[model samples]
Target chain A: MVSTVTTSLADVASSNAALRAFLHGLPGVDRVGADQRAAMLGTRSIKTTAKAQAIDLAISMVDLTTLEGADTPGKVRAMSTKAMHPGEGAPRVAAVCVYPDLVHVAVETLKGSGVKVASVSTAFPSGRSSLEVKVSDTALAVAAGADEIDMVIDRGAFLSGDYLKVYEEIVAVKAACGDAHLKVILETGELATYDNVRRASWLAMIAGGDFIKTSTGKVQPAATLPVTLIMLEAVRDFRATTGTQIGVKPAGGIRTTKDAIKMLVLVNETVGDDWLSPDWFRLGASTLLNDLLMQRQKLTTGRYAGPDYFTLD
Target chain B: MTRLSVRKTYKLYIGGAFPRSESGRSYVVASSKGEFVANAARASRKDARDAVSAARKAFAGWSGATPYNRGQILYRVAEMLEGRRAQFAEEIGGGKKAAAEQVDAAVDRLVWYAGWSDKIASVHGSANPVAGPYFNLSTPEPSGVVAVVAPSDPFLGLISVIAPVIVTGNTCVVVCSSPMAAITFGEVLATSDLPGGVVNLLTGFQKELVPGLAAHMDVNGLDLTGVDDPELALKAEQDAAENLKRVIRPVAEDWTAEPGLERMTRFLETKTVWHPVGI
Candidate 1:
């Protein structure tokens, strides 16, 4: 009988351990700190072609930031039409990220592009205005023609330990978006830590952010390995908890194939197979396209293409 | 000719104990003279956690203290700051005159917040009119543990953000600017007798410490008044939302231009009570 009891206890212990492990494996459904998330991402191997494919797919779906003050509403509409030409091999750009005022331009520009128009609101690079004005700015951007509103949170609020206010504002902004997607920019460069980055990512997701983007490209220390890792973990955890696959966008400083590949590796390792698709991933960069195109050409012909080979325009 | 020896090391301030950053990583601390002072610790999430725990533990006594009593303590802090005015002026970025003005402003703001502690309910609070003969009143209360990314520059920015939060009874885990003035502020906090954990100071990059506080579940709020980057501010705001914590965004106005009593008042939640009136 004693031996039988010991066997039963051992069985129970094994099952308990298994259960705990399974629970831990579930993606955390909340914002995680940058450092902790980075450590987890770092633990996994960077080798995975599947990860690279996911990143490629994500890049393809991006709304590519291509406005240079020359984007009139008509011009933007024309570009959107071309982007969504839907030829035999034509794929869609995820969304078109544009200046806050130009959101309507992109909206009218890609009215039928099937591509979402994302407007950079909240005073863009400097969120120094009053809350009333910021909220109004987001509302106006949404009303103008944006299918998605990219709103910058008040950094001052985040630094002051007034997180609820920030979260509430995002929620309000998300409500303001109506049917439009809400992509929240963390500007990871100014945030300074993988832990904070993870936290910011989680916060944005919970506050109804459709996508969590890194940096405005205007700040120093744009995007880094550790910061990206934290954001990926946040997405993974958010998906596991809510059964919702939130999107990830690493903006600023991502201008090369190598950088894109690294971020892809981070996402795949942290979030697993489900998130390896365009719907859940995106790249917010201006210069990254040329590098990616160059890499793609090299892969196809096994020869380095000169900068002129691809029309940068 | 005599050779001048240079020192390299940053010490962490915990419960009045000056130790190296627990991470064992030390970064350069430059002074106004362009000289390196000491290498400070690169505080980690663990250190931030410890600091938060310390602040949470200390909140009961600190927040529970009578408003008059709290005011006296703040007054004492002002007094001490006044005495050390010259030292702070020298350490803060602006020239002596500018720094002195900043110090004075900070002292005045501290006193201003101190006075508000006992009387905020009257100034910023109100009674609601109900359909029935019911009395409803709302008064502001502390939001508990706050994680602050202090200004990277110093003096006015730092004091402007930090004082308002604590004056209203919230304990703070502040990540002071990378170098210089932070150490001096730590000295000011050390001598203030404002309770051990009521204001825990961590000297490091705002980028490094903010994430730790943002992700910590125990932290009730975040203040990103010093972070200049719009994207980072948005991210920090987003992260704070994960836990539904209170967040205060950065404003463009000069913090020193006027007393930011509203900033402090904004962080407070008005808890209203209702009772039926009998004839």
Candidate 2:
């Protein structure tokens, strides 16, 4: 994936000051334009045959997530089972995201199904732990057979203008994740601005994250369209400059098939077809899968499906 | 300077909100003399789908409500209807006295059903004499969401069909033939203590809406009283079998007559409970 321009961007990581200069020198986001563009792209009405395809694509791109403190092994197993077979002939979800402790349960349940197990680590939802603890947390999930590690960024450090602290933590966690893919959760709700989301997206990609995620699903306003749009642009720009493509996962607030389709629209319009696959884009939601399944049933059966028919998570 | 008259557009009531039909279509609702009265929102099958969803969402809360509480809310709806008598009579478009009588009958019919909220269960339920060391009791339970087709009798027919469904703790999605009065009845329901989605009124043709509701798996019951067409009613009843929905057959009715316990019991399921004696 390395391009000739890789060395020029890699030099910025040599120092904290260089990284800050590059992140800050990137053009500031016009908040209004980003909002307007996201809203405009959202208005595209995908209907009939196109809608059916989009529903299946969105289902495949779902990282069926359960990040609650009360998530148990049984719950994880059930969720994993649902993730692998949402409905008859429906595409399996891209991954199943759980708290770090339940990684093995999901891994065991999803064996031979090809659905990746993603564990949120780094004292997830709030990256307030020491780097030693965070690295071990990633290592624990990796050892438990998690294929992906979703580590939260140090919001306290990032908010305090310590970009290097956040960058180094992501790097340490990435190193701990052996062969597993790394998804850096920005917790954009805490970041407070679009430019910061863009900067955090770049920082995670530069720090060797395989995917740049919007949130840990524990925060409010976890993933908004505009924030995701900004992240998509950052990934697009990163691939252009460094020739390395980073996946985008917008976790949390997306709870409906319509919201899932809107996220797809944002991806399709923002970075075009290259980022539309499950490998590049994922919706980190728990309830979104059932809605997609219901919609898929509606499309195939020509009637609306009830929540009663689908098993509750 | 003269002020512009604000025209009242008839809209659908779903989940307690007055929304224009998603289809963005309206039909000319005319008086008995065939003159156009107003344009009523012509709800499509999608609207039926939305109304069923709303009714389903409201089912848990409405059905869980105490029978006495439901009675109070139904009584409150009757009170609201009483106050709106003149508006409903004018909307129904008959002689003032006759229209007013129809509105009064609807109000009285609602009150009658409201009184049955706490008593209907007792009337329909029974204690079985089982030859075991246990007490076996059979009581009626609200059968989830109901989809109803209201008769063309603008006020009395609609109210008679709806009040019984809701008073029994069942939420309903209703397709009413008289658009103006149905939407206006929505206003009365909104002003009452009754919850928004407890009774969703869709102003559209029954032929267009019944099939969708019948096919809706979430809807537990269907009242086909308003569907005058035998073919449409048969098709809906057949489709309702997809989920084994309890269906009430179409029947001509005199709204002013005393209503039997049948309307209240039609959409109710008999839940039998067996308990050890003295436990």
Strongest candidate by lDDT: 2
lDDT of 1: 0.70
Give the lowest summed-lDDT range of ten residues in model 2 chain A.
Answer: A1-10
Chain A TM-scores, all candidates?
0.76, 0.97
- What would the DockQ be for model 2? 0.78
For residues A125-216, write the lDDT of model 2, one tens digit per residue.
78788999999988889999999999999998988888898888888888899999999999999999998998898889989999999988
Best by DockQ: 2
| Per-model C-alpha RMSD | 22.1, 2.0
List chain B TM-scores, each candidate.
0.89, 0.97
* lDDT of residue B196 for candidate 2: 73
Q: Compared with the true structure, what per-residue lDDT tens digits does model 2 show for residues B184-234?
A: 989999999788788999998877888888888788999999999999999
Pick the TM-score winner. Answer: 2
Candidate DockQ values, in order, are 0.01, 0.78
TM-score (C-alpha) between model 1 and the true structure: 0.46
